[model samples]
Target: MQTNNTPQNIAIIGAGASALFVSIILAKKGFHVTLFEKNPKAGKKLLATGNGKCNITNKNLSLNYFFSSNPSFIKYSIENFGYKEFLTLCEEIGLNLVTNENGKTYPASLQASSVVDVLYNEALFLGAKFSFDSKVENIDFKEKAHIISGDKTYKFDKVILATGSIAMEKLGGCSSGYELAEKFGHNIIKPSPSLVQLTSNDKEIHTLSGVKSEANVTLLVDNKPQKTLFGDLLFTNYGVSGNTILDLSREANMAILNFQKVDIVVDIFPTLDKNKLLALLEKKKKILSGKDKNSLLLSLINGKLIPFIYKKAKIDSKKYFIDNLDKKDLQALTYTLKSIKIPIDGSKGFDSAEVVAGGVNVDEVDNKTMESKKQKGLYFCGEVLDVDGACGGYNLHWAWASAFSLASNMK
Candidate 1:
């Protein structure tokens, strides 16, 4: 093993968020760091984050924000590298940040490219080398660390795998990172598409396509309420896509993999309960006694969605007058409005997924340093690990946190 004071040769695969962060840290720590990216440019996915604004980090850093097969695996790295330290480093590297009311931090310039540029510039200035269009194909860790990319082979004292997951192929996401881990005797949890749009077979969903609403979404796995999230939801010809659905999708993906029943229960009127909504509808019915059922819902709900809502309640919009509606009709409408269950068959797949849910099992990696337990001089971090975070800036936080932890322990 190299001594703490000695400069070690380090190889990092993939040029995503964690790769860049760890490379910057280790290079500044006097290590000779070389980042190998398959793509012509680094941070291709990073450039697309937060719609180009780049949600860099969250002010509230907690273990609850992250998900892993080993749930507590993120605590050590996160405790070592919190948002304050990350923000300080960002400032030192000349990247100004702004924290909004929601505690989601972004570049003051509001450009994801700006964040990536600052990180790349800092790493380069610190003497870190970058090899673009260099996709690593093989790793021979039998004797020394030898990584072969095509015909060329590079040896290193230590290698860090920061290659993300098989999500968003448009951004160069692939399974090479997981294959590397498997070669080193690490077990990988089968990856599934998370934070992606849901696909449904419900024909009614097609009619309400393009309709957006603020709603509470609950994911039911095996007929149990696994999780809930609140945000804006959008109906598409495919199915449901939005902040709320993406937040709840991790559980949906996992459940689908288990062959368990998966369903999305959306409460479009989350602020009002069943009884309250029923009372409101009753009062409205009295006022609009002569009007048709469609007219009564027009002022209260999205016109495009009125037909679907009434149909779910078993009420005929064409025949029923507001006064003719019975208790059963009101109850059905209340329940439908409060709990509109949409059966999710599958996701949009990795091509449309924002992040993947599984990776190199965290049990095979050290939480403190993100070093692989199965091999010396090998490390893992970011989405390549089992750890994944919710939407907003949590996933980026994991990247920085795990990278910082690994770099600190590199000799």
Candidate 2:
């Protein structure tokens, strides 16, 4: 608490997750907090999170799920304000949180608007002021921070940049945060799309559009295996989507930005090895010898994928009968099933990305305080920093943890 008779004024530049969290905390600390949001309503991005269910945080809070230029910079904040602390904060704000079996947490009501309404109301109840539709154009740092928004200039004892990243521009994402940080002599790692769909140039793969399956996806960059994951995979006309693709998209997009050859090897039958799959195919062929060769794989895979598989395996469905399938032909089919490589052209970019992979470099920011080392009284939290997390509520957790760290330590 301040010994000064006058309450210190603090301006937060965004009304998203971190901004709201910090506003509530600062207001509780007896500081006059004001949130400047360009959107007419608060939590525009927050409301869209987790498909409107709002994954608040994850039970499995670990550094392994997050990415950054300096990965360890997030360790302090996350450790200090982990899941239990977040739950306590939520409870104090009268927000009930529930966790799924996979450890993804959401509001007990499971309505994203409920979470936003509770947080916004709590901040308002704490006497925090909001400047909706007020986009901060610039901040002049001196002994006091002067926030310029259109024709008005507001002075503050301190300013926090919670403006988020340039991902999902349609959902209120912008580059102003990076621009502000750059003006203050902060280094920014080039931003790239993460948790986004990966596009492929393979026309045949595009023909498999609307095909959904569970598969093992391996991301190969420059002909070397980078990462592998298994989950639901969806084939789209543009490219591939699903939890697996989104998970691998970070590394894939990073490689693509660097002009590296990227490909994803999708194993349609993840449960079966090549030899087992071959044996299964051979067994099917022998049992259904009288069936049309084109219909042989109907039970094994989606019917829409039959033509693609046949084309890739170099087996002519019109020429070869089920009984006439040679061992080599069966082996080729099995190989194609196990290793269907799709050449990645690019990603859907920031327009459709869930979160961006880069922002103001974390090395210049204090991990414990969320304060900029380059400029005192200027702080950062949430996705505005280079730190980002994997899908499944990790990103939102970072927002809460980083906000708590900033609010707890801000003087």
Best model per lDDT: 2
Score every model by TM-score: 0.97, 0.98
Cα lDDT, model 2, residue 179? 95
Please give the lDDT score at residue 242 for candidate 1.
94
Best-performing candidate as measured by TM-score: 2
RMSD of each: 1.6, 1.0
lDDT of 1 by residue, 119-157 (tens): 988889999899999999988886679989989999888
Off by over 4 Å in 2: none
Tell me the TM-score of model 2. 0.98
Q: Where is the poorest 10-residue window by lDDT in model 1? A: 1-10
